[model samples]
Target: MLRAIVKQGLRASSRLAVNRNPDTSSYVQQLEAEWETAKPFSELPGPTRWQIFRGFQKGGQYHQLGMDEVMRLYRKQFGDICLIPGLFGMPSTIFTFNEATFQRIYRTEGQWPVREGAEPVLHYRKNRKDEFFKDCVGLFSNGPQWGKLRSAVNPVLMQHRNVAIYLKPMQRVNRQFINRIRELRDKDSAEVPADFLSTVNHLTFESVATVALDEELGLLREVNQPPGARKLFKNIEVFMDSFFILGMKPSIYKYFPTPTYKRFSQASDEIFDTCSMYVNKAIERIERKTAQGSTKDEKSVLEQLLQIDRKFAIVLAMDMLMGGVDTTSTAIVGLLLSLAKNPEKQQILRKEILGKLPSTDRDFSLEDMKSLPYLRAFIKESMRVYPVIIGNVRSAGTDVVLYGYRVPKGTHLLMVNSFLLKDEHLFPRAEEFLPERWLRQKDGNEDSANVLINNSLNPFVYLPFGFGPRMCVGKRIVDLELELTVANLVRNFHIEYDYPTETTFKTTFLYKPNFPLKFKFTDVKY
Candidate 1:
């Protein structure tokens, strides 16, 4: 019956065409037939293909605005969840901000759940099998490969005790960064340089590399920094920027040698080469210690990972270095920007830091960080307002019901936390940054701010680090970096933006500030 209808549609379409190919006529007929049958997806309101196509023609506004525009337009018209048409008249992608539905899907996500990044890696491995990705699979792979990688690394990277091994190294990098900030500030204006993002990137790269590879790249040092470190930083940035473009857009890069694909390939080589160099060094060091019978009780992340699989260790380190640097720095930028905008909150945090870290030279132990509740609250509040990653995506592993609609398996699900965070019912005065909202009472009473907020806010809505098994593995490291740096900065100086810096949404595989952040730094009086 369906074939008969398709044949009739093809006949009708063929009649109107001046000179259409068989393939084109057949595709049009199929699309028309599918359009008639797929009423459930169409019932969910979204912009028409013409509307999206018109925006695409108007100087690439569709690509520039990207998912943010989709979430905004559909959520306004269709409430929490709606269908969003894809580029080039592709099937509609599901846009959801419903927390209950998200929880249901995530909790039931199977062992081989599909994720957002599998396609790009699969393409890379297929094309560069001999050159770049010969030995290992990427972290974002699905099915058995993803399960294997996750299980091997989780025991070492995700544990609290194993992660705490990097505290002293992070402290050293933090101190170097603070000192670098002191040098970068002007004497008269008392403001740091406008190119603060570069500094933050350098710091985060140094810290993550130290922990992930067990090598001192000395990226924070003003003099005699490793040449490979500088190259690695630039390459990682290029890799991230190009990955987003190639992954999101309908480009000829996949089939032809486009400029973006060329850049991505080159950056991938540089990143892999740099990580291999460091991994080999780390392995040699461990071999020497073992041969000499030098028994150290606790091993670094690289060592623990090497015990599982050497190639796995190298590839995971590359992922950590390549993927972690920009994101961790972006979070720091968000935290500092949030505090800089609100001086009173900055002072409150400064008092907490000063009380805990009395001397500038003293390092913040894991215990010390755990004691500072206000500092933790401040970081959480900053992330809540300006998330480093805008939202989460899951390709449904099975046919699931979301928001009363039976969404089919393999449909793309984009949960827009940016929309969820701004809902006034979930968060009172949602636009304002109130760190106290995340605070808890110390009087052993039930009326704590955190308790109240927890009661009111749905558990699924506040996933800054994501949720369940697929949550970020480097979350603990990011936490240590933020707390230590914020503590040390507050201990030494009072943070305030010299001018009103406008926050614009920019994308480089993740959301980051598009403008310069010039912060005024006044020395604190004890």
Candidate 2:
């Protein structure tokens, strides 16, 4: 049937072209036939054909698309799951605006796995050289290895009771970030040290450095980045680019030697070489903890992990650093951009903060962060709009039927989050930045107040931090940081938009506010 269509396209092309060279005409004939065949796929309403096809295209797409742009493309091309093209390879079916589809994937990661082909492994190994990353983290392992590390690591995050232990270090780090912003504001220039990516890159790495290792990188305070700090982040950026962006379709290199393949190998080395330093440092810290008889009350992340097994804990500690940096930094950048675009919302959040704390007084306390309702809502809303991971990718391991589409074993499957976050079925005026959307409840499970698109509040749609057992283990830390940071800044300073209403947003990994916005640190008017 496919051959017949191709032959028919050849006949059609022969009639259309004035001078037909066989190679030229044959390629056109092939592409035209593919388009014609793929056109029917858009008509299939289920996720089967549409979701898979869009997965491939999205796999191929590497733009710095903000959440809005990504959703717009997904909707415009809804439910086209096959990879064959139309209008020069662009799909017409936007992804189904299905938040339940989002729910299905988020709630079901055991059903879907992150195991990419060996080509992607090269990239992962390059950026994460730690033995535990190579062997332990759920990101790398599948069954027992994933279960073991996940079991050990997740408890650390789940027990928010323990976060109180982290409070003192986090206060020092958050102050560094706010002070860095203040220093930039004082700078007398237009560009005035923009690039929120670079800013967040420093903060998160420093957080993990202190929280995990009890070391101060001082990235926020340093006039220049500390040794290995800048390089490690650059390697992270490269690894992300090589994996998500220009690095798709790497299977071709599995069979042949090519320039692109060579570059991938080189990048893999640079990423690994840079990451090794951190891992080695982690090992040293774990040993030091053992020598010093560190207890839970006195332990850093490395110290606690060392209780498990020294080497294992060291690698796992490094794993925490690698995993923690990109996700939270991406999120903070997203929150800042959303705040910039929604000045009214930012002011509302600030009020929630100021209402709680009469003044900065001395500095932020963890207890002060909890009561800021709108502040939390503002961060939740931003995460909804410009999520970092966008959602997990899974492999079916065996043949399965999803919504009646035949999904064979070994096919890469995507479950999209950006599509659902803006699904009109889930929220009103889906694309607008309305933090208030998170504040209401439906049939009255008032505890769902913190839930995004709370069905009790709006249809159960929130996966920026992911859902269920495999959901992000670092969520509590991120939440604590966000609520604390925003509350402290707003309590002490008047942070307002300095950039024009237009083009306040930029994307690279996630949305970001143009800096030089000068979150002016004024003494609170008591």
Per-residue lDDT tens digits for candidate 1, residues 158-184, read: 888876788888888888998888888
Error of 2 at 493 (Å): 2.9
Q: Which stretches of candidate 1 lie over 4 Å from their true place?
A: 1-39, 47-54, 60-63, 77-79, 85-92, 131-135, 442-454
Model 1 residue 409 distance off true place after TM-score fit, in angstroms: 1.8
- The lDDT of each candidate is 0.74, 0.55
Worst 10 residues of 1 by lDDT: 14-23
lDDT of 1 at 501: 60
Across 36-134, the per-residue lDDT of candidate 2 in tens digits comes to 434342244433444434554645342445544654565466453422222222222223334443443322234224443223544445455354345
Error of 1 at 496 (Å): 0.8
Error of 1 at 364 (Å): 1.5
